[model samples]
Target: MKRILLACSSGMSTSLLVTKMQAYARSIGDEAEIWAVGQDKAKEGLKSADVVLIGPQMSFLKEELQKEAEPLQITVDVIDMMAYGMADGKRAYEQALSLMENK
Candidate 1:
């Protein structure tokens, strides 16, 4: 199973999205273990994740998040705002996989 992490300022909004994404993943038979956390929670649990994805509200932290994730060898990216806003789970999932693979 692939591990995917989603983070946001408060982690509230993204949590809702996580639920939707998980449902979508299940429908497609994608076996991703998804988790959503506040930026602070990410700091505590990042070691377990394969990739870190930031919500648009927390987008500015991308550079910092990347640096922090370096030792863990985890790829991180800011979620596409439009896709996220519309709650497009599959696209976001694809983006995370692509980024991790290229890294």
Candidate 2:
């Protein structure tokens, strides 16, 4: 199963998106362990996550977060604004997978 750690400034929006990702995972028979949290909580969750996705609203932190995420060796990306605003789960999972593959 793939594990995805999604983060936003306060986790409020990403929390909603987590449901979408979960539903998508189910619909496509994807075995995924996905969760959402605010930026501060990502590192703890990252220990077990296969990938990490950040919200575009928090794009400023991407560089610092990348530094922190390096040791874990998990792929990290900023979720597309359109996809995130729409809460498209399948797109999110695919995005995560693409990052993982490239990493």
Candidate 3:
């Protein structure tokens, strides 16, 4: 199973997105472990993730997060603002899968 970690300024909003991602994954029969954490816990979350997606509000941390993730052979990306704002989990989930595939 793929482990996808999502980080945002606070865990609350991302928790909603996690639910959507989970629903989308189930709909397509994609097995994945999806979770969300506040930016403060992002590093800890990264330890177990196959990929990391930072919420738009936290996008500025992408470079720093990527540096931490690279050595662990994890792909890191910023979730698209439009998709995130609209709570489009399918798009976000697809984005994560695409990043994993290209890696």
lDDT of each: 0.84, 0.86, 0.91
- lDDT string for model 3 (1-103, tens) is 9899999998777887888999999999999999999999998899999999999889889999999999999998999887788888899999999999998
TM-score of each: 0.91, 0.93, 0.96
How far does residue 8 in candidate 3 sit from its true spot (Å)? Answer: 0.2
lDDT of 1 by residue, 10-93 (tens): 788787678877887889898989889988887665688999889998878889888888998988888889768988887888
Q: Residue pairs in steric clash, candidate 2?
A: none
**Which one wins on lDDT?**
3
Cα deviation at 4, candidate 2, in Å, is 0.3
- Please give the distance, in angstroms, between residue 87's alpha carbon in candidate 3 and its true position after superposition: 0.7
Candidate number of the best TM-score = 3
For model 2, give the 10-residue run with minimal summed lDDT. Answer: 39-48
Give one digit per residue, the lDDT tens place, for model 2 in 22-92. 98888989889889889888767778788889999888877877887798787678998888989988888
Off by over 4 Å in 3: none
Between candidates 2 and 3, which one is better according to TM-score?
Answer: 3
